[model samples]
Target: MFSNLAIDVALGLIFIYLLYSLLASIVQELIARLFNARARVLTKGLRRMLEDDDHSGDLGFFGRFTFFNFFYELGWSVVYFFQPFKNSPFLKQFYQSPAIRYLGENSAAARPAYISPAIFSQTMVHLLRGPHKDNQLSDADAIRECLAQNSLQLSADTLAHIRDLFEDARHDITAFRLLLEAWFNETMTRASGWYRKHTQAWLLILGMGIAAAFNVDSIAIARILMKDKSVREQMVQLAMSRQPQYAAITDTLIRKNVLHRDSAFFRTDTTWKVMVRDTSLIGVYGMLRNDLGDAKNVLGISRACVTDTTATGLPVVRCGFTHPYQRNGWLIAAGWAMTALAISLGAPFWFDLLGKVVKFRSAPPPNTTVTGE
Candidate 1:
């Protein structure tokens, strides 16, 4: 019975960590947008590909100019649109093709907009080969002159490669276009890695903040849950009853709310209203509300575990402090650190752990027959 209770306590902690990680992710997304980290990395890559001098630090113009910003937003939009389909093999192959993926057969004339290395290469090639006096220039010369005019810098090796490709495919625009696409794809892949690294870093920072804000002392909570049989039983029962509901809500949240659209960008009133109405954001909101409603009960348990009586016989609260640096100090700090680390592991990790625990609990005990019977 004690062993089963321990498992329940562990599952309850996993559920809390999952909730914390989800909140952290939402906060991290907002922080990413506020910093425009994705856009900055993308624009930096574009500048490197276009420019002549690698020393030039003039990316202010990209932010200032509407033309550059438009392309930046368009590129990110493409990344955002395909995010949900990242796990789908067919969609992944479709994204790499030159042909645009249309919404449906009925919308044949209207193609869903997206950007890729191929698209980038084609656009730049058209820009360089535009109808004007510059059209008379050779492809290599035109590309060089365009880079010079824009004050964009490319590494000597990159420039040499581009020039060689241009010369080799001087008459074959298709072959040159393919080479350019390959180069851009490689560079963009690296940029994507950079974006992901920054995002993880932001999540860690947010996790620590959330741990402190909620006073999520894992060590203290575990001790309390282990000693208090009544509270442990209540928590176990609540977890068992709510696990299915939580799973359903989480599925809806991921499929319909979190991954359906880019959370970083602002939306129109009509779109925002529709999202609010249909998305699982409301489900998350309700979950949080319910958790907050239970906060007092949780606090009561904490107080019962840690409270003391003064000489006057008045009860003094000793456990719940937002900062871990007071009272039991180092021990409390360790608990906070444990919570922050767990949160950094992310929501999916905790959710998977919870699922396994639930599965184990649901499994039947080994069959046994009494010989005396």
Candidate 2:
């Protein structure tokens, strides 16, 4: 089992894995850098607009990005309130309500709602302050009454206070909406200001600059997305005709030819190499075809083939307590270890490691265990 092919495959996979990881990190860094610079440029523009005494209601770049993000997040919080499956239902109204209203429902997490500048709708901001002229009740009371209307009960004091705050709630809603409209006007003016300041930059992008930027960003995103699990699977399936039983041992083949270049689309006959890294503590396994073209599945290896030579050609593989993760890149290391383990210990040792990772992904744990589930 300690064959040259297996060693070469494993070494290739590990190298590819490292390279892919580095590239991914670099892309992420680039995005972060751009985001921060973009945010700063916007912030500076907004500050300039806000400083102009004669400037109309406008927030500029700073208002749109820095301020908008906070406000948008504030609005998004309200979305949670509207979420059908969310814990609190009365608060659904607050997702559109100002931050004060949001907190009345969830005091621990609430913050002020900022106005959005997209369609220019926000006009009422008075409701967001300490006390609007329309105040009729405390924040706590309005939410409690709303909840009670929906059948959720509260303490006697909560009930009494809500009965008093009816007018405040009504006025508060109006004021909140008005704040958004007014803020919208200001932010729009600010955006206009930013444009005036960076007109040259804007023109550059509008001309050939944007076109090049589009190409660069598009290429980076495509590369990042191509590295996904689904893409790798497709590549393997496409290459099945030529590289028979290619599952565990051909990552070098896959990475060098198929993946980054999308050779599957052009090359009719080839093997696909892929690398799998365990990103979560929760054990998981996913199937990937070993070829880059749509040929017959030559790499017969699968989680089920743990006890046999499997279509991929060599030994059976499994995931177990010890071996929690497996990937094309690790195949060389795994194959040799298995070969040695088989020689000195037994097949179960290798099979167990592979078994754990495979079954977990197949019979995945409850939502709690899955990342971003």
Candidate 3:
């Protein structure tokens, strides 16, 4: 039902999205490494569950300013800008407690990215039991007593909720522990949602940045592919030739091994541990430089300078910061926005779509039997 030219153009666009999405993923991984994103997300979720104030709006004098006050009211305020985590005493203590204190690489500073439900139960039980010289009260009874006395400074709603869970468990310490684990697991599902939402925001920002840097205007690219028969043919050939390589990259086993330093490349069985050790941006880009070079060949995108002969037959081009955006600024911006949105959908999505499109193009047309309806 579709023309060959249309299919080829679609292939070229999908390939572009696939390449840029992979690049954006690498950048996102680097950012996650630098910020300990997983660990922070876990801690944030725990703080919210514990009803601990993370100093989200503890902005002292600045909190009086209309601008800061506006953000505070909008629920987009920050924590620890002026005052430290003074408002998060319980959370600070929980992290510093014996059960959790040594779980991370930097025991004194970093928090663990993952905390099993069992470990969470253990930590909660230990914190609830508190310090008693005699240790007279059993774990469940101690937690109940603490809640009754408001020793932990927990909110009335949290206190009532835990008390109900305890009652539902029939005050049996084992059952209470199980119930606690179940509750923690349920809360973590929401935590994962929080992480996903923030990650998408970061991906969008990275997509826009990469699209602008590379002049990957999707609209302009589609126009070029539609009008230039030679370029379309070349792009189709390029896509067909590189299909196996892209497939390998997208394979589940290979993707899982990407960040493992000692993992060997499955295709060549070669080691890349040495290459991964260099954390510099140049070193990181070097790992994917070959694919990037191929992507640069996609038509309608330009880098560096272009030369042309004037009416006098003299070269009138200088090699400076020449880019395709110098002309048709609005069109180029629109293209960049479109490309960015596609890239944000991610590498796997585009690659899978590319395979389907390629298959449809190659498959024989549906049977056209002349049977009467």
Which candidate should be chosen as best, given lDDT against the real structure? Answer: 3
Quantify how close model 2 is to the true structure by its C-alpha RMSD in Å.
23.9
Alpha-carbon TM-score of each model against the true structure:
0.61, 0.18, 0.76
Please give the range of 10 consecutive residues that has the lowest summed lDDT in model 1.
265-274
> lDDT: which is higher, 2 or 3?
3
| TM-score, prediction 1 | 0.61
Ranking by lDDT: 3, 1, 2
Give the lowest summed-lDDT range of ten residues in model 2. Answer: 280-289
Per-residue lDDT tens digits of candidate 2, residues 1-373? 1223333333223222222222222233233233332223333332232222121224456555666666754564455334422433222332334532432213432322122332112211222222433548554444444545634332344334333443444646454345444544555455544433333233222323322221112222223224444534443223222222223323432343211212211112211112123231011111121121121121212233345577888786664222122333344344433322222221122223333333333353355454473
Worst 10 residues of 3 by lDDT: 261-270
Model 1 C-alpha lDDT versus the unseen true structure? 0.57
Report the C-alpha displacement of residue 301, candidate 3, in angstroms: 1.9
**Candidate 1, pairs of clashing residues:** 51-152, 51-153, 51-154, 52-152, 52-153, 53-153
Q: Which stretches of candidate 3 lie over 4 Å from their true place?
A: 1-3, 52-70, 73-77, 80-86, 107-109, 131-135, 251-287, 303-326, 368-373
Q: In model 1, how large is the Cα lDDT of residue 16?
A: 72
Full-model lDDT for every candidate: 0.57, 0.31, 0.69
Candidate 1 C-alpha lDDT tens digits along 206-305? 8778767767778877876777787676766666676777677555544433322222221122122222232345556667558634632652423224
